[model samples]
Target: MSIIVLPQAFAYPAAAVVSTFWLTAYQMINVSIARKAAKIVYPQMYAEKAQAEASKEAFKFNCAQRAHQNTLEWLPQIIASTLIVGLKYPIPAAALCGLWTASRFLYTFGYTSGGPGKRSLLGNTAINAIVQLGFILGGSTYTVYQLLA
Candidate 1:
């Protein structure tokens, strides 16, 4: 492998770690805001015995939503990054890595605010395409380089 490619190969995993940190931060902030909003809106409901159960359920739903968002944001990046490292395609891998991170951000914002479905769907599709394309291109390039060498 070229010396330049070596560092780029390492960057794929590093980018994944950065993406994970971003996702976790986003989740924490989302849950915190949701919990605060729920508490303010349903303080009386939370206090009343009959309404307490409903409040609890609401809280649980908020938590679940946050978790879902986190998963949606991080899972693709993890998969793409891992593939990049394993397949040895730094350029496409890096591009996909960036796409995964960007999509996750878009997805998180869209999901949190209940934005239009098209935004989230587009983001998801873009990330998926990047990962798939990376895998194909990286594998092919690696094979060709090996044969030529």
Candidate 2:
């Protein structure tokens, strides 16, 4: 039996799946925590009918925060995935994608917990940079490989 190497395009769908999982998981966790925090902070605020309306506003704030965080986390994945498709370097691309996902998880935890701002941002940014570099290198390598072959 002979094994065949699949083309780089195959990585696109896999990367999408991974990206979706990471983004969705992070957003869900953020929203969950935000909701819980709101409830804790405004316990009596939601007691009466008018008060419920006011309390709902707090929940909305949490939702907005979750959306903001989700958007920030998604930018790197979008860039990385595009590069993976263009470059067709599956192995390194996939590895970087995994690292990006992990870093986002750590970032979400750090951000929600009010960890040191510099440390959290630095860690997340480093991972984002690594993913970006992989994409650039992968594209260059693919270009060379295609030219040679």
Give each model's whole-structure lDDT: 0.55, 0.55
Q: Which ten-residue region of model 2 has the weakest summed lDDT?
A: 43-52
- Candidate 2 lDDT over residue span 38-105, tens digit each: 56354432234443357764444344354446556566545546454445555655565666666666
Tens digits of per-residue lDDT, candidate 1, 40-138, equal 353332224444356664444354355556566556546644554445555555555666666766666665554235346565856756555665466
TM-score of each: 0.53, 0.53
lDDT of 1 at 125: 55
Q: In model 1, how large is the Cα lDDT of residue 98?
A: 60
- TM-score of candidate 2 on Cα atoms, chains taken together: 0.53
Global lDDT for candidate 1?
0.55
